[model samples]
Target: MKIAVVGPSRLPIAPPFGGGLEVFVHRLVSALRLRGVEVDLFAARGSIGHIQSLEFPGIDWTGFEASARDDAYPPGAMESEAAAYRRVRKLLERSDYDLVHNNSVHPAMLVMDPGKAPPMITTLHVPPQPELQQIVDTLGPSNGRFTAVSRFTADQWRIPTPVDVIHNSVDTDQWRPGPGGQGVVWFGRITREKAPHIAIDVSRRLGLPLTLIGRCVEPPYFRKEIAPRLGPDIRWLGSLPPEEIARTVGHADVALVTPEWDEPFGLVIIEALACGTPVAAFARGGVTEVLKDSPAHLAVPGDVDDLVRAARAALQQPREHARRTAVRRFDIHTMLERYLTLFEGVLTR
Candidate 1:
């Protein structure tokens, strides 16, 4: 089957660079191609380029860009995206693809003329933003099929359209544990919503050295909410490359994921698990689902004492077991097969 995968424009697809969404998009496309599916990626101008093939051998990479004017934020974000929609629509007018799998949450999906379009399926990575939701509600019912990254996100939106849940998967091979290293690790953005402060609190409670990874998109918020709390025991490593992240995680004794808000899905938890690093996270959003049957432990959200206890318990489990479970359930191959089935269903419909 021929497929067109759309990605967010705000960031590039390079690893250790974008968030879970971009990483998920890249891995999914690569996996699909390995299964002998043809794939084209629609992204920002500099995001991706022609690739010979994914590691899986048969998959090829074709890249397309959004229009020039549609590259800014806020006031023009919609217009820029609309311009991109026009580009995609024009492509659809001529191409005979089995399906167009859109990973972006933009209203552009709604803009495509369904009569001339191939069957379309979209995976909503988060609850719709206000403007984006307006677009989706207006266009989703008539033209697109919607899928949510988790049931929590789907329930939050109360979307009138048909919605399915497809949990995000990890590249377990790339994330498994290495030689056990000391210290605790925290990955993801350093925002109040993510509760980086809680990680610091856990480290202090356990008297373990802590390392913080991920970008700071909101400098002011970081300063006001996270920076003041940093001290000698805690170190900010900024963002590291994917391999570097894997290595860091692999060496760490425990991974801390404390989100103040309802996270749609905590990719870091699985990423940490892939490295054989046990996760001690707050029970929120889809985290319970991810850790449902794993060696990972969860505490009540915002309870530092509970988090500390969970962390301690996780540290006691054999690292190899956690790593093995991650490989068994969250492996890239497993994710690839699930997406293939979803695409096939869309085409057959």
Candidate 2:
């Protein structure tokens, strides 16, 4: 089958990825191709070399935050992104592709009629936003097929139709185990909502040096909140490539995830577990759901003291158990299978 896959316009679906959204798109596209499905990936400027791509006009999207917020977009940022999505949506309506797999959150794509488009499945990777919700409300309950990264997000949207939960997955082989070292690790976007600042505070209480990885897109938040806290004990490593990220996670004694907002799914949690690094995360949104059967520790949401205790407890959890949980729950092949089934079922219907 020929498919058109759409991801966020901010970054290419290539490494070093900006965040989990890019990583998920990259993996899904590659996996689909491997299964003999022809995929035309619609992404930003630079993307994976082998796949057929229809690029979006490049725009700096680092400034945009959640679309629900008033200040989510800088001047023309939203306009540029919406224009790009609408352009693709037009093509998708006329294309002969068997189906459309949309991973982007921009509401412009939803402006089209459901009857005119091919079978489209929108995977909800972001939290609820007013723009998308407004379109969804107008479209009514049965507009299109939907899936979410976690159950919490599905409930958050409160879509009247059935929304499947396809929790994100990782390749355990790529993120292999290592003899863990002394320091603590925190990775992902260093934006305000991600709250790397809290991780720095938690690291200090533990008395173990902390290494912060991933891109810093929010300058004001990084400057006002993160910069002042940096020291020899607490340092930011910026972003690393996929392999290097996995290696770094493997070497850390414990991984810390501090999400100040309702994260749809904590991809960092699974990545850490894949490396056999125990995670101590704020139990908000879909975090506990991901760690439910694992040896990772969970603290009450927004409670620093509780997070510290969870980290302390996590350090003692068996590394083998962590690895076991990742293999059992998040193997990439299982995710691929489910996606394939969903696609075939959609086409059959």
Candidate 3:
């Protein structure tokens, strides 16, 4: 079946992925094409890579300049993306594809005229946004099929529609187990909300060496909260490709996840588990659910002493158990089958 997959325009679905959203889009599109589905990706520029034959990417909504680029809500960027999706209304309406999987989560995507477009399904990778929620309110709950990365996120939406909970996963083949080292590890956006500072504190308290990975999104936050804490015992490695990330994570004895806000779904948790690394995370948002059945430990949010206890406990958890948990629960094949089933159901309706 032919399909149109639209991803976030903020970042390209490429290696050294900016966030979990990019990784999800890249994996979803790649898996669909491997299954012989005709797929067209509508994503940011520099996303089209050496991937497939029937999976050529179409539109590139990159190159939009926002004067204050690093600000949380960049001024011109959002407007540019919205206008670009407005322009895409014609293309989406014209495509005779079986379905349009709207992975962008951009408000304009759902606001556009769906007059003659193929049926649409949106996977909300994040909690509800004010702009997107406003659009959903106007659309009156029947614009498209919806899914969320976690049950916590699914319950956050105030819409009158049902949102399917589809937890995210990693491709186990890409993440192999490693002989774990002595250090602690933390990976994700190095911002305050992700709270790498908390991980550093916990590591220092426990006297365990800590390694930080992933892109530095908020340099101000990094400089203020994270940089000063780095030393011989703590190291910050910038973003790496998926394979490299897997290798680095696998080598660590334990991973610390400290999120200040309610995370929609902790993709890094699964990635670490896939690499045979147990996680000690703050019991916030969807993290509790992610580790519910795994051999991981969760501490009360923001309690350094409690996190230290969690880490000590996680270190004792067998690495083999962690790997087994990933294979049994967070396998990519399971996620792909669920999405395919949802796709078929949407078509049938």
Taken over the whole model, the C-alpha lDDT of each candidate is: 0.76, 0.84, 0.82
Which has the better TM-score: candidate 1, or candidate 3?
3
Q: Pairs clashing in candidate 2?
A: none
Candidate 3's residue-wise lDDT over 212-296, tens digit each? 9988776668778888888999999899888888988999999999999999999999999999999999989899889997433
| Candidate 1 backbone collisions, by pair | 70-80, 175-274, 176-274, 176-275, 177-275
Question: Model 1: how far is 28 from its true place, Å?
Answer: 0.8
| Local accuracy of candidate 1 as per-residue lDDT tens digits, 1-349 | 8887777656666666657887888888778877888988776544554221311111112221121111234444556556665666678656788788877766656567788888888787875578767766676565578787788887877466768887888887677677666789999876667878789889989999898998765566677767887788888889888989999888899999999878898899888888889889999988888888743488988899999999998898788878876888778887777778878887777
Superposition error at 307 for model 2 (Å) = 0.9
Best by TM-score: 2
TM-scores, one per candidate: 0.87, 0.93, 0.92
Clashes of 2: 0
lDDT of 3 at 163: 86
Q: Relative to the unseen true structure, what is the Cα RMSD of model 1?
A: 6.2
RMSD of each: 6.2, 2.8, 3.5
Q: What's the distance in Å from true for residue 109, model 2?
A: 1.5
